[model samples]
Target: MISSKEIKRKPDQDASKHYDSVIDKVLQKLDTVCKEVIDRTNQNNQQENEEARFGQQVKQKPMNEERKEKEENALLLQLAEKDKGRLHLFIKLVDYMTVETLVSINQTSMSMLLEEMKKERKNGLFNTAVNFDVQIFTPDEKEISEHLKCLLDDMIVVMRNTARVISHQSMIGYIKNTKLGELLSEQKENKDCIADVQGIITDSIEYQNIKNEIFEKVTSDFQAAEVYVNTNYMRCKPIYEFLNTWNQGDFENKEHTLDIIKSHVMELKKWLADINFYIKDIAKGILNVDGKKIKNKLQPQVVTKLENFKDYLYKLMQKKANQTLTTLQTYTSNLSKNPQNLKEYAEFIEAIQEAEQNIKGLETAKIEVEAMHSLLKSKFDLNPLKNSDIVMMDDIQAEYLRLTLKIKEAEELCKERKQEMMKKHEAEFIKFITNIQNTTSSVNKGKLILEETQPADALQQLNEIKTRSLDRFKELDKNYQHYAKLMGLSVTTNKDLQELEATYNDRRMLWTHSDKFNKLYEDLQKNIFTTLNVEEIEKEMKSYEIGILKLRQNINNLSKEGRDKVLDQHANRVGNVSQFMPVIQALGNKDLRPRHWKKIFEDLGSAWQPGKTFTLQELIADGVMNKKDKIEEISAKASGEASIEAQIEDIKSKWSQLSFIVNHYREAKDKFIIGSLDDIIAALDDHQLKVQTKLGTRFVAEIRPSC
Candidate 1:
């Protein structure tokens, strides 16, 4: 039922509404996406800012930690290196004891074999007798058995002592050879490593395992050795006694007596040889011999051989003692004759320690040898040697005492020499310091004078100070070098010298510039006016200008206040001289009249006074000359003279007109009679008179009659 136009409009309107709805939905989607993007960007920016603030600290923390860890590790490694010898010994002992190829015996037997294998191994009497085949037949089996059992017990005791010593040594060696061992030993000295070492010990399974293995092996071997020796010692005594008494029946035979003599001789040789070995060990700081026990076990032939050996040892000790004393004397002589620095003194001290140790060793050897001498005498009633006196410990001790006294004297002398040298050095240093102080004081005084006094006086005083300071500094420098050389040092660039030189150079530069500035100032003062010699003032001014340029070049070297003061003074001088420039230039001008001279004097104001012979020079030097205001007044007056003359004429003409009017009025009144009083009465009624001039017409006077 609708029209066609209405239908067409309805479809178009619907399409338009749909298009607007679609556009609005698309715009909402875009807004949401944009908002999300903006929020993400803001979060990213915040995160980047935080990173920028703390990034350096976060990055450097781990690096610093790593560096510290490396330093600690390096310190521990160095300490471990010092224990290398102990480590090597522990490793060797473990390898030898635990070798798989040595399966013939337990570790205890191996340890005993190791001890016997030493070239300097010692044996008991029973073993010595068996090895040497000494035959002694006695009918008493009990006596032989007892002797054999005692020897076997002695052997067991030696073996047991040996095992105990080796076990202790191995334990100490194993502990000190590891890093943990080093840390424990050096904990007091290196406290910084204590925590690290503790951590390593607590945390490191490998270190714990190593420590356990060492302890277990050493303990096991020692216990096994103790058990083996205890069990076998009694069983071995019977076998030992049987072997020892196999040749017992031959005791009365002549050949048997000869063999016994030979056996005693061989035992004496072995005993003496052992004594010789003990002497060598004592020399190397090892003292393990017991002299009294050996004395109780001696035989007759052995005592005789020992007596002879004693004489030889006495001579040998005496010779060695004399040699040691001679060496000490040589050291003392060297110490006395040479000048020793710290290093040489340290060397001498070390030599003294070594010599003292040697004397101690000889004293010990002497004790052992003297004990043997006493034993021989007591046991066998042996007579003293006919030709040789025994070298007692006292003789060596006396020489040691003399050597110490000489060293003390030498040390005192060295100390005295050092004191004397230090005194001389102190005197020189005081002299040098005093000179520096005096120079500084004088320079400061010069600076004050330059600031407060006149240029002439300041320059004179500064020159004198400069000369004296230069000479003193030269002497001080020479002596400073000498003092440094005496102290065994080089002082080519000493701090005191550098500072003094800088002060001197600064003061000297100031003096030079001050002299130049004063000269220029004086020239300006003196050449302010022309002289009788017409060109003199001009020539001086030219020279002053050149000096001004040169002074300006180095003006910055002065302090700010000083530079300003100099510039101000120069400007004042130039201004004072310029004030007279016009006067000087006009001196040759013949056109100058009295009025021109008056104008110039007026411009000078209080600077030039009457009745004073005025020269441009005198005017410039006048202290009270401060009339800058009159300069423009004088210039204007000088430039406009014709105008002044014209104004004067105009004033004179006005005065003439006033005078004529007065005279004319008086004449006219006198000529009138009483009858012509009408004009006079009119004139009297008008009491004011007017005069005309070039200015204007105005009332000049009032008229009055005497009546």
Candidate 2:
């Protein structure tokens, strides 16, 4: 029932199984080897324990019978001769064996443990190596000294128990050799013997038993110390294994995970520093080396973690930069199609601003990244996810402004179109005009609206209306001229009238006089008779003649009044007429009459009255002249005796005020001639000539100054 595929896979599956079985067998063989090693170590420990017990029993024998009896007798003889011999040989041995030797053993073992721990960290031995602290190995001098002191104190207890056994054996020997020894042996038969020998020897036996109990306690303490020191290896082994397999390359999201890695590295660093401190301060003398070698092994791992973290950050930044660049490029592509409307233009402007902001953010990120790694600058350009500098931010800003202006323009156009839609069309506007009773005012209002709303078409429509009105006016003019001819009156020609009307019509489209044109149009529409008939012409002519006669009469009345004033001033004033020439010039030829000048000269003969002898003040009071004019008249007649006297008195009173003014003018005239002011001349030289034809030449002089 098996398929061909399964049949073919069966042999491969069997081969895989065989391979697994072979691997399992190898692992089992390794396990068996490890077990054998452990068994051998246990056997060695049992042999050591048996040797220790045999050594203890040998040490329990009498001191004199021991191998060093001769040397011990020599040491007793030497101590007896000394005046002070507080140092016991037994104490010296205890100090060296328990304190010094044991401290060396512990320090060496701790140093080896710390070395292994460092190797584990370097290889990334533990899953949580950053969080885990290796076991406390060697401590500072004070702590190690304390451990040594405690161990030495326990050894001292064992040494004291041995000394008790030696003392008890020595005392029993001293008693057995004398009556006390005999007495103690005889007292042993009695349960409660009062003899000193028996009581003392029995008490010594009991004290010997107490020494054995003390030795047991010392052994237990020594085992406890061994266990405490051995913990260093047990705790450090796992960390080493973990570090051996740890790999920085396996991490993901380097930027986020780097924090954790860095934190772990820092914790590992602290652990190393702790070990270094212990080695330097306490274990240096014991191990014969400082822990400086371990730092080299650990530092590389810290660097690797940090490098991986930086790579992660770089990749992250590059990705974000690429995204921003893509967004900007997309916006740029969209903008190439110029926006067709205000809304589209506004959207374009928004896109440009957003792109510019993204560019600014990218620039900031680039600066931050550069601050972290200066060497990475060139590498960043080569990174796959890295984006080149967005050089289009300025272009984007320009585009923003351009789009803004475009939107404004489109809005204005739309607003104009809306206004045009709301208002009437040109044809409709003409109809509205025809329906209005006050066509002038209505046309004026419509013209203003059209000019602002739809200027070109509106003006053209208004001009057409004006042309039609002009045609009607011309027809009416012809009729008027015909009526004038019938009445035998000189008529204004139709051609001349048409030319004048044409001038006004030319300005019909202008805002000025627009209302007047409209009114003219309305007047033509209302008049049923297009022409002025003979009777109407006669009446119009009579009205014209009456207006002319009234105008002439008014002019004659004004002339009579003006002539009287001239006569009165000329006859009454015994003064020069030169001053009155300015008054004649001021009247102008258009306002003055010839008869007024004739009367002025005629009255100046026999009618030249001296008038009442009046002072200059009196002349001003009479309103005949101002004080300046009166003073000028006196100056003109200064050759006369009376004028001289009047001038003398006037000069005496006003000399101070007028002296500076007179001198300033006199000096100015003198300097004016010295500068050759009147010699400077400019002329416009223009000549017209024709070959074998008449020609004219003209010149105009002008004064110019150059400085």
Q: Highest lDDT among the candidates is held by which one?
A: 1
| Candidate 2 per-residue C-alpha lDDT over 1-707 given as tens digits, one digit per residue, 9 for 90 to 100 | 23334443343344335434543454355345434544555555565576567875754667666548546644644544331132123222333343333334334433453344334222211111111235333232333334333432333332222222112232343234444446556755782332232223223444345444434433443344334334432343343444677666665624443346445545555544444433231121122122233344444654555455457655654564455445545655554545444334445545545555555564554445343333234323333322343343343345445544544554454344433332322343344334332333333344433323333455566566556654555564554444334323466444444443443333232322233334433432343321313243334334433433443343223342423222222223212322432332222222222333233323322122223222222222334333334333332332232333344345445534432212334547554223322222211111111211111111101101110
Candidate 1 residues lying further than 4 Å off, grouped into runs, are 1-438, 441-452, 482-488, 493-707
| Model 2 segments more than 4 A misplaced | 1-177, 182-301, 353-707
- In the order shown, the candidates' Cα RMSDs to the true structure are 48.4, 33.9
lDDT (Cα, tens digit) per residue for candidate 1, span 1-707: 23333443334344335434643454355345434444555555565576569777755557788679557655655555444434435443543342221221223443453344322323211111111113211112233334423432333332222221112322434455466456445653665222232232224464345334433443343344334333432233333343345342353232322234335435555654443332221110011122222223333334555454445444444555556556655655655555444334434444545655565664564455455445445443555733344443455456556666766675566556655555565676667777776665565443443444555665666567667775667776775565455445556654555555665555454445455656644554465332333245446555555545554554434444445344345545655655555444444243334555555565555433444344445655542135434543444444444343454456556545542112334458555333334554554344222212312312111111110
Assess every candidate by TM-score: 0.21, 0.23
**Which candidate has the top score in TM-score?**
2
In angstroms, give how far residue 633 of model 2 lies from its true place. 99
On the 0 to 100 scale, the lDDT of residue 81 in model 1 is: 45
